[model samples]
Target: LVIDEIKGRDLRETLIAFGEHLMGAYMSPALIGVYRTVVAEANRYPTLGRTFYENGPARATGRLAEVLEAAEARGEIDADDCFRAASHFVGMIRDNLHLQVVLGLRPPPDADEARIAVLSAVDVFLNGVASHR
Candidate 1:
């Protein structure tokens, strides 16, 4: 669903959409609970961690990498490694806000906060990767 929305969009648009999806997922209490549970039980069932990584973060990173590869091909960005770039972008999107939420240090960001965070991340990421030409 999210991947379909990001596909064919320009780099900035794709990143914004992906960031929105990350914010939505991170803000969900149910999803957070599941993540906590997964972490807590992962040591006992190592496959649980691998399964979560493959199904969640790995899938998201792969989809983002495809979009990034397209952007590089079109000269919208200058990434020699789309997968690595995608991982960095995803990290920026997650940021410390996700950590705060996961640790119960703070509630999930409000919509306005999330928007600001996403936009900021997009700007910084583009500054680093945007095509000079």
Candidate 2:
């Protein structure tokens, strides 16, 4: 059995670090690779299947919130639109990504079928967020 271990990191510290990177002050290719690897792994593993979707832990909440907040602050989108975009993003993550993790499907490469299934979810999320303007 492959057991996933959690490290004991302070949530606030982690959030701050994420904010720093996401705020565009510093971009981390490593972080992007990590997330890509996650998707790839989820595309693997048969048991993992399509359960990766709806996996709340896998959803990057810090990035999501920061993006919404930044957009609002810039007046790029109204509050209602910002919230709508966030909701759309969250919903897609829940229904597609989290759902895949729940199905026991490890990331892609191991489960290509699962990855294919969720692409539409990603598209929808992007479209929704962009529409928030």
Put down candidate 1 lDDT per residue, 22-44, tens digits, no spaces: 77887799988989999999999
Q: lDDT of each structure?
A: 0.87, 0.42
RMSD of each: 2.7, 13.2
For candidate 2, write residues 108-127 as lDDT tens digits: 22234434434545555434
Best by TM-score: 1
Predicted structure 1: clash tally: 0
TM-score of 1: 0.91
Q: What is the lDDT of candidate 1?
A: 0.87
The residue-level lDDT of candidate 1 at 86 comes to 88
TM-score of every candidate:
0.91, 0.33
